[model samples]
Target chain A: MSLGIAIISLLLLAGKQIEEKFTRNVAGIDMVIGAKGSPLQLILSSIYQIDAPTGNISLAEANRLTRSPLVKSVIPLSMGDSYQGYRIVGTNQQYLDHFQAEFSEGKTFEKVMEIVLGAKVAQNLGLKIGDTFASQHGFDGEGHAHDEVKFKVVGILKNTNSVLDQIMTTPLESVWAVHEAGHHEEEEGKGANALKLLEEDDHHHDEAEHHEEEQEITSMLIKFRNPAMGMMMARSINQNSTLQTATPAIEINRLFALMGFGIDALKLIALVIIIVSGLSVFVSLYNSLKERKYEMALMLSMGASRTKLFILLLLEGLIISVIGFVIGIFLSRLGLWLMSENIEQNFHYDFNVLSLLIEEIWLFCGALLIGLLAAAIPSLGIYNINISKTLADE
Target chain B: MIATQNLTFAYSPSKQFTFPDFDCADRETMLILGKSGKGKTTFLHLMALLLKPTGGNIQINHQEISQLSVAQAADFRAKNVGIVYQKPHFVHALSVMDNLLLANYLGGKNQAKDKAQSLAESLGFAEHLSKKTTQLSQGEQQRVSIARALMNNPSVILADEPTSSLDDDNCLKVIDLLTKQTQEIGASLVVVTHDQRLKEVFEKQVLL
Candidate 1:
């Protein structure tokens, strides 16, 4: 019993560490909007960089939100370029400030077509300042490489342990220019003429307002002065707005809550498994006691105390629980690491190893409590062992 | 030395036992021989104070164990007595030395590796000092169990069927070694068994 208690206690210790980290990552952000797909997927792709973007919105609509009374700063993002599997996200200078992407090598992008790579992207791709690398046409590296539109790696971001660590960011014009190089007479049949696109692509100005059609935007990341404004803005967009307004923070909360149910269920299952394992330990010790009653009897006659027998049985449960706790934590950490890689490649989000969440701590505690409960019954069984009958049987 | 006065015990409301007073003086080896179902082990247990006697008292090394508090009884048990079982049992996960160390620690005996190694050698378990008890044979495990019982050098040893699985020669060897160790340590030995072969091995006799 004591052994079971000890095992669960150790797992709880590790779970507590994971929980603290998860809570910190979810501390900020409210909503995100760009495409018309899942609100969760939109928020995940735009804010956390964990999913694919829904679709592109007109740049005019993305920027016009800034004029609204409820809106604050709309951080427009244009993705779909990569250097050796690492993603390249083109955005305004505010992105560098928003995520605090510092330059470890040279300077942030100052010239058009200049690129800034994330620390991991740079390290993984083996590119430095003055190095030129062409981006793959799309974010997933499935599209053709735009070798003609080569971008110079002007800057390298310092490791921030976030989504920014594995991405390459450049001016939003870079994304348009990459696609503009492949424009031909065939694709210009129904869409806007390639000549006008050439003029718009040549000059770097807010030309969408002057054009009959609006500019295309992959997504927009909005930051509000008052966090509550996010709800009002989202409500307005959902009501009769020109475009969809998705809150990254709200979506993330709903996601966590929804996942909390699933996680709570998983945690409950893990806890139950731990208890069953602990119970197996208890049964093992108690069965040993039944078989070794005579041995115990003989020991008692020889001077071993009843309490020592109790402790000995309890110790067995503790050992098993401890073993289980260690294995369970190791497995959970491995599970998190495995999930991180897929998230990085698919959505550009990297789950950090060091940061733990609050729920993980609770999970660890629950494991410990289960261990203790399992071993308690067996430890008490030692008291009932009748030494005389046991010795005679021996 | 050990003594029991008007000792009694009951397994349940239906089963009960009462025995006359008994005692073993210091430095004595008493062979307790009994028939099957005659409560021979029960009498041995009564003397060890393992059971709460519904009536009377048990005294070992001149201290009344029945009057001792729970903790005191535990301390007194660890210090004053040891037992060797018929079938040796051990904490299988631990190595032989670790099992001995656990016994020593829980028994309130010294936990010195050097001392345990030396003791193992003295008992002819020198090469198997680090082996798991489960890896040892029945006889070898018996020796380790005996080693555990003798670790604290208690004033008394209660061995139940100590040589149960042994051949005649090995049985005699075990009896001699255990009695010799007990005598050297000034501990009274009480051997409980159904086999009468051990009756001639002891000077004192308690028959049931």
Candidate 2:
């Protein structure tokens, strides 16, 4: 019974926390513009950093949208390389200002090949000021190393309790320089014809062409002057523009709707377990009353009222449920703490387990009601005890 | 004082009993003796207000109790009547002292811990007061039962075949304790038993 309660409570806590965290992290950003493909993929890749980018958008198109009257502020992200497994995000100070992230040690990056690390990234990599490391071509640290230009760690950002803590931040020129170096190597290996063939095989071929023309960026996170303008802009961009637009709020809500079904099913199973446990408590009390029929009669003959005896039995049920509730809540917190520890070690994600929620209060009341009903069902037998008959039999 | 007039009870229409009249005044002991099949326990239960007699006028301290409601009768029993059973039964979870205190609690009287201690001392089981009731010997349990019956200083004390399972010597000891404790508390004592050994112990007797 306790295990069932614990599992449900833990799931509820984690689900609420994750939903709130996702919403809070994306609260300011109204929309994302990236290479045209899946809108959800665009939002997930740009805002959440959990998925691959749909494709790259030219820096000229991103700059054009930034200069629009409907747009409030724009933060251009140029991604493609990684240090270890953490993505090295190339953006300006606007990204840090938007996330309210501050420096924990040293200062922000000021030049090409100089980087500032996020709190978790620095801790996990054990990188410090003045330490230089080469970037890998891909996000998971498996591609060719850009050892030609080793970037120096200039500073570490404070823990923002957001996705920013799992990334490294540097100038946009840093990412362009590394990718340009890779492009040069391809150009030198086989003349202009080989370069064109390589570009044909590349998914971001348009991005490279645009980079050659000027510069290219992976995506742009945009905040509209009014949230209602996001719909108008998204429609126009999806219909006429090559770039795709996705609203973070809509995509996140869709994601939650998909996850809600599984969570609700598990919650129902937990509730059923609680009900079965309540029935088990009822059976145990009923059997005990049968065995103590004579003893109950003896008590009655000693002037104990029937109501008093009934309440005594009911109290037994209440005590059992209350104890189970307390232990169940404790177990839930313990389970969450262990989960947070594992996630922190593997994914650098932090979860607040010590925070209490209002839903748990309602859960407690529901549990107590189960206990009362279970106890009351069997305690009703007190009214039927025959003092004369029971005592005479023994 | 306790008295019953025209007391009648029936498990069914065919199985019925009309008990003879009986009265015991303050500090006096009365024995209702009968074989196993006789209605001795039925008569005792009727007097204790645990079973309502189909026809009877039971008076305790000059108040007629037959017409009382279930709740009222329970209150009256708690305040005026005490009972010791054939086989001593105590809540095994409680200490010997708590079992005695339960009488006062049920009777809606003060806990009277000192009174419980005095009763335990007089009954000769004061040393076992802190022990669980199950830890005591059968004879010791009988003594605790008698002490519990006197805890509320009730006006009437009823014993239902209290010595039925005891040997001759232990039976005499139990009967002596019940009678002596009732006298000390100035309560009327009534013992219903199939035990022939108790016939010689009381002068006032009603045989069924």
For every candidate, give the share of true A-B contacts it also has.
0.42, 0.70
Worst 10-residue stretch by lDDT in candidate 1 chain A? A1-10
Q: Candidate 2 lDDT, tens digit per residue, B70-168?
A: 989888998899888888888877899999998888788889999989988888999999999889999999889998888888999999988977888
DockQ values per model? 0.32, 0.58
Q: Write the per-residue lDDT of candidate 2 for residues A1-108, one digit (tens) a residue.
A: 687789789988999888877886797999888998988888887887877878888888767755778888899898888888888989988998888999989998
Where does candidate 1 chain B have its weakest 10-residue lDDT segment?
B44-53
- Give i-RMS (Å) per prediction: 3.9, 1.4
lDDT of each: 0.70, 0.87
Backbone clashes, each candidate: 41, 0
**What does candidate 1's lDDT look like per residue over A1-394, in tens digits?**
2333333433343344334433433344455667676887776666655566787887876666557766657678887666676777889898888766778899999777999988878876788899997888655677787876889988898987666777788988788777766553324544557686665454336454434235566888776778776678777766765567776556656766775675566546655655666667667766876776655665565456677767776666666665665565566556556666766555555555444446546655655565566666866766876655555553
lDDT of 2 at B189: 97
lDDT of 1: 0.70
Model 2 regions more than 4 Å off = A1-4, A64-67, A123-126, A134-149, A179-214, A226-232, A239-242, B167-169, B200-204
Instruction: Give the B-chain TM-score of model 2.
Output: 0.98
